[model samples]
Target: MAERKSALKRAPARPELNEKLEKAKKQVITEEQLQEQRASFVYGNAPKGSRITKESAIKATKHIRVVTPAAA
Candidate 1:
């Protein structure tokens, strides 16, 4: 009896997606534009001395730092 050899299968080739990729790339926002939009959302047209809300407090805690002087 002759031993049977296993045949190797080739993977299917990937389809071309350059058009889809270009569309996705165009949809992406630039970092500078994103920053400017976020700044506007956070600080635009806010009333003076408005009490900070919980949402703003969380944002402030995430982005702002407090420094305390060393005790003498």
Candidate 2:
């Protein structure tokens, strides 16, 4: 015959863990933070003392000139 299983017990909580949880719960994100995260995800890492934002966007030239050899 098999024996019955007992209920699992919980470990005592630490004050440091509680503090960290409280800090995380109270943390808030700002618009700039969202922008930085988005930039990092799309463009990889940033440089020291400076970060790339959406303001510096790259655009392709719309005008192109094509010339054919002088009536060869």
- The residue-by-residue lDDT of candidate 1 on 1-72, one tens digit each, is 998876777655545576677787889797666655665666654577887554674465356445899999
Stretches of candidate 1 exceeding 4 Å from the true structure: 1-26, 50-72
Q: Model 2 Cα RMSD, Å? A: 17.3
Q: Ten-residue segment with the worst summed lDDT in candidate 2?
A: 56-65
Model 2: runs farther than 4 Å from truth? Answer: 1-12, 44-72
lDDT of each: 0.63, 0.57
The best candidate in terms of lDDT: 1
TM-score for each of the candidates: 0.29, 0.34
Q: What TM value does model 1 have?
A: 0.29
Q: What lDDT would candidate 2 get against the real structure?
A: 0.57
